[model samples]
Target: MTEGLSLWSLGLAVIVVGALWIYGVNRTMMTVPPEAQKLSPDSNRWSKELMRETYERVKKNPIDIKKHLPPKLDRRYIVVGGSGLVGGDIVAHLLARGQSPEGIRIVDFAPLRRPDILGVASNVDVIKTDITSPNSVKAAFSKPWPASVAGLPLTVYHTAAVIRPGERSLQTYDRVARVNVGGTANVLAGAKEAGADIFIATSSSSVAVKPMKFWKWPLPSLASNYVQVFNEDDFDQPLKAHDEFFGNYARAKAEAERLVCAANQEGFRTGVVRPGNGIFGDVENDVTFGPTLKAGDIVSWTPHVSQNWISSRNVSIAHLQFEAALNPSVRAVPPPCAGRPLLVTDPCPPITFRDFYSTVSTLSVTPVTETYPPPVLMLILAYAIEGWANLIINFPILTKLFGWKEPTGDLAMLQPAVFTVSAYTICDDSRARKSVEEGGIGYTGVTDTLTGFCEQMAVWNARVERGEAGPLKGKGAAAPVVA
Candidate 1:
């Protein structure tokens, strides 16, 4: 009789634990704050016809970024990471505004791959240099410019950084810190050595993101703290603890930003531009929309999460605006914009992940598809993946013992850190928009999020119609867990 009672007790305990697990997952996943709902666009607004019309309209009358381009200065340029999304756009804008190609030098780890900049590649010098190595950076910057523009003052735009949003472990800090932190220091030293009068580093708004706490006891009716408003206010305060940031990437960037801002002096003006989350506007290599478009399908767990986005072009514009603000000839002595970080974002309100997925699905001729999984389930999987990754990283013998390979590509990106950044984040650009005289970057976004998405889709659709690319085949890769 006692043995039977014990068996019954074990069964009851199992049932209770299972029931509690289900309840916690469902409650956490389903609890969206009222403010988040207000921030998200209505589901009714994301119809196929609407997205199609927007695509067509944008194709007919595309955004004219040239109109918003800052007037070109005569200064010679050294754009580190110039082949990347933001740096590429900076190079294109400089050329579009009558800056001579000879006057621009691209110091990047990667060769020029951007189609837009490839046309001018021959005229501009491309110096492949790794910023992590102080010697490499110094040599790249020390290389003599063409005699024609050698006399012009130099402005350096440092835009390179390894982006691993899902990584939060201090164990993995060395990898990112080598590039984001050490590289920034190397680039800053090299620029000063090269006699650069102005330096602008590309920073991320993720620096201000606080980690999300979803498993609090007595689970609240709403996840109010998950919704955050981001600006430059954090710059005024002491840097938070590394764990306080969403991940290692943000922590490294925060340090890099401090280094760049503190380097500002009477003649060597320095600043940082913090682009809002979800930077898109590239046909390839964009972290947000491009991955879904490339895969031709998305497995989404964030349909209701809303976050601000910024376009690469607009980010580039902010950099140039900062340069103008700090230019000795353009502004008064001790420029108000120098020695600070400015946050920038699209001019529109935040949009839900569903909105982004729907726009791509509706407009892509490649037949994009989406599946919405439970957010809590994905969160659980992220933790598991992170554990396995850390295990393999910490113990190389385990791989040989169990034939285990480290996660790569999208799978490697799945981690608990992603959840913090993927939460509802709305960035405000008002501080950056204030006039330069008032201690701001005097920034403006040329294209809003929807328009930017529509414009990119139109380009892809045109390429498909012209038979330049695919109606691709096979199952698409898994969508990224974080934008």
Candidate 2:
């Protein structure tokens, strides 16, 4: 009898332990951060006091108009984010168009890297600028223009922005707001002060997208319906301020767009372009540093999700063509590119991630299938990781010792929505093309763009194999080699 009792007791203990473990796992999966509560202004992660102080600084130092009257119009370009990928390409395009190096000025918070890729344009003036600070922006614009292009109206391309996943957290949201929102105000004010009549700014399609509302498993299929294809008309449908993940970034961008549009009257003619997923060839980062899978590299395939993508080169071209359409003659009164933001994207069918990946695949004798974690399981994992991050960041001692910061829950929800189950995600580039006879800067076919990207990757990979390119951090590390 005693032996029988011992066996029963052991069984009971095992059952209890298993139940406890399951309970803990379930709780973690359901956990949501305390900060992401409502989709309202009260849900803004930033401290109110910090926002007020930053706004006051922007207002105190208004743009000086005396120095910037009668805008010059002879291709005297002032690129705000000139060191970045798209911005760098714009500079390259300018050089290709035979614009003198002295005629171009690049203003960025950080110095440009890989000047060799830019043909080592010795005459291009590089200004170190902090867009968030009104004084810094003023100082950047105050620099005298080259005498040769001094009389021509300058076209300001303000593309500098703070875009990162960590921006969703309370610790970093204020910095995003100050720079993206208030910084844009300063740019508009500075442009007006500098007599910059033509302005082009870069915006993202995220401004019009809403977070996915996932369906339950078994009955509804656990996927969202392809009910809507986002267009320029949907600009009003923005992510709420209290959205769990991308809300802050979306809200801040919306504000910046508003600022740019509001400044499009009389002396200032401003236009904004909203791009879809932008991917392209990176010579500086992809070649000189590390190389990922290149053309002719054997790569496996998977049934990947589909989304719209645009080439970086096309984005650069569209900027110039839009400017040309707005003001045909150098001194003619240009029309305002306001009322609506143009949606610029490649004229290609929605391509699956696998289709994109296959561009670099080698000619293999046999095909291979790539496998990925189940979406449901991955979602659960995201919740658990986020919960763990919240615990670490909330505890003062733990944070101090481990240097723990709140991780933006981007991977948990936003990424899954984008990669696994996105709705009709194509942007219509027709209106922008019709507005200008250039037709969206004569977009390159999707296949050609993919081929071009793969070719560049191949070149870089060959260099790495030959030891011409030194050791890279990893397959594709995120190092700011360009900007």
Candidate 3:
């Protein structure tokens, strides 16, 4: 009789263990909203596994941005900030990749709103929006579409900012925050309302800037310069002041970036792309480094400061890639990955700051180091940038003072951005290149920075024809190349 009882007890324990396993399975699966589970078990497993793998790869694997973006389930994409060089490049890449402009949408703070390529605007729709106000974003997304337009949700590529090297101020910082952060927040809300599946924010490497409030800090220049920007480093070394700007531009960027992360946590599948030195079409004019130029059109530069620069075209492509990787209809794509924040340098590294000056001086026909203004001038420019950034952030319309005379065109980006690349931060992209070469995605390199610079000057000259700038009152005919 005792033997029988022992066997019965063992059987009961086994039954309990099986029940617990089933219960746990159901419980975990339930966490994935019921709407999501209705998908085929195989599909569900694939998605869940992809999501898991994506996070794991991000944390442990060598950073391969391509592998993280899953294959496309739905192809429609929306590009915010498409009016800019980087944003426009993203839209064009989407077209090159075969996404019909009918499936493409572009939005910007600039005045002009036009249909994307593929003549879709002629049939579908083109939108204009103010990112800071959710209302503007929602209106843009809700534009009427015909039956010809597929109902598939979207992959949103947000690549917009109001930064220029020479433009800065507290008010400007607030303006950037409202637009960068606020506009992002509005877009996130709009995406949710429209049921867009993936979100990719064109982030900046500027988030890595660190402050140098320390006494006798070794990396003071580096530290102070970064402090003027912002850092995403999750460490306890220094506590950040949450209230306001170190200078206007950095503060707004900091807040905007923070909001973007918050948006990620709130269930919108998001990716943040931090790129440095975008050298695409018109970026050189009145944006990028244009604001840094002195009244005499001199650039605010240090010949020796090494920085990272990437093509605006590459950044645009990265957005499409993130979009292509997403699963449409679902709220989020799992495991191959979710959206991520990456530092997009270049297929190859950039020249050092010293190299940059050497080349530009040679090409622009100016003595770079010698032409570099006094130390006091650099300091003034730095302070002026901070001040102007503050004004712009607080009063968007007030950017006129920075020579940002128009609400549209290259007037928004008031300065060139200087991205500091530490030795370790620059890594090899052979794997990514291999993937692109395999034909799943595509990319190209800006081999010669000087050529890139000349290309920029040429584009700037074109903008004068665009009526964005008046007839070129002849400035330097061509940048003189040092023999």
Cα misplacement distance, residue 324 of candidate 2 (Å) = 1.0
Give the TM-score ranking, best first.
1, 2, 3
In model 1, the number of clashes is: 0
RMSD per candidate (Å) reads: 2.2, 13.8, 22.5
lDDT of each: 0.85, 0.57, 0.47
Tens digits of per-residue lDDT for model 2 on 1-483? 999999999999989976555444333323222221221122322243433343344345432322312223366888898887677767766766667788888989877764334565556788999998899999988788778888887788888887643234564466678888899899888888888877888887666665554443323323333223455665545434545334456667777877787677766777777776544546454221122332222121112334566666667766776676556464255543443477776655454444444433331112222334344454455456556655765676877887766544334333332422233344556666563433333332233333344444455545656665444442233221110
In model 1, the runs with Cα more than 4 Å from the true position are: 2-18, 41-44, 220-224, 470-473, 476-483
**Which segments of model 3 are wrong by more than 4 Å?**
1-74, 111-124, 164-172, 212-239, 242-246, 265-267, 277-280, 283-296, 299-301, 328-333, 336-339, 353-370, 380-470, 473-483
Instruction: Please say which candidate is ahead in TM-score: 2 or 3.
Output: 2
Best by lDDT: 1
Model 2 is weakest, by summed lDDT over 10 consecutive residues, at 294-303
**Per-prediction TM-score:** 0.94, 0.71, 0.60
Off by over 4 Å in 2: 1-73, 166-172, 215-222, 225-228, 236-246, 283-303, 328-336, 363-371, 392-397, 401-424, 437-448, 465-468, 473-483
For 288-364, candidate 1 gives per-residue lDDT tens digits of 65667666767777777788888899999999999998998766596677899999999888888888888887788
Could you give the candidate ranking by lDDT, starting with the highest? 1, 2, 3
